[model samples]
Target: MNQLSTNWVLGHKVTPYQTTGNYNLVKGESPAGAQGPPPHIHKKYEEVFFILQGQMEFVLDGRQSTVTAGELVNIPSGCLHTFSNTSDESCLWLNIHSPKGFQSFFDAFGVPESEKDAMQQSLAAERITDVLKRAREFDMEIKIP
Candidate 1:
């Protein structure tokens, strides 16, 4: 079993706790109500979003859906999807990607800790493209909605 914790480190706001069996369970707490990762498709892992608190707007397969507390949404593998926090209150949620250990790719190719959050924001396209390429190395495909 592969287990780990990813700290936001400077306002990234999301902490990825552990990964198991194609599922990477990420805990995110954000007051800024910021946007999330860009739309992409996963070749090996299927993703699901389980809302623990507050609300989030999820766009899957180019369609829109809202997830509130205690709700969960499944995004099939190879589907494009993205999520964002649009509420006034802080949003907390779990991003779970199946077939786990996806972080291995991130830890290997992700930007330096200092530039992580900023890079995630400013270079959304490039960053995600790099991530997708890295994921490919691990035989993982990011599903796009």
Candidate 2:
């Protein structure tokens, strides 16, 4: 069988490419004080976050909730959502987006294998208008917080 090790995939100090999917699979791990993206919505893609370890805070539609290990959250398309680690330890989780295509989205907004560190920082700091424009180009709607 083909074994795709973690080292074989693209990653950053904050994240690791444990796996990807024909659909979308989030093999996410975060240290204490870590947080994911700001509140945003993908009008065309559904997402799910499965908490595997530690505790996290999930904010959706302005409501906040804490999720612990073994819990899974399903986010419908077009709903704004975000997550953060509030515990003192590292948190591990999976964030899966359905129907793929988010890889391109992620690459455009943050560090991908093809970009330099500075460029990645620029991508991460991208203006909301630019992000929205890219979203529009991708036929996805992104709502800023």
Clashes of each: 23, 1
Candidate 2: lDDT of 133? 60
Give the alpha-carbon lDDT of every model: 0.65, 0.62
Error of model 1, residue 104, in angstroms: 2.2
Q: Weakest 10 consecutive residues, lDDT, candidate 2? A: 4-13
TM-score of 2: 0.68
Which sections of candidate 2 miss by over 4 Å?
Answer: 1-22, 109-142
Provide the lDDT at 7 for model 1: 47
> Number of the top candidate by lDDT?
1
lDDT of 1 by residue, 8-84 (tens): 42234555664435466767675546666656667677777788888888888889987899999998877777777
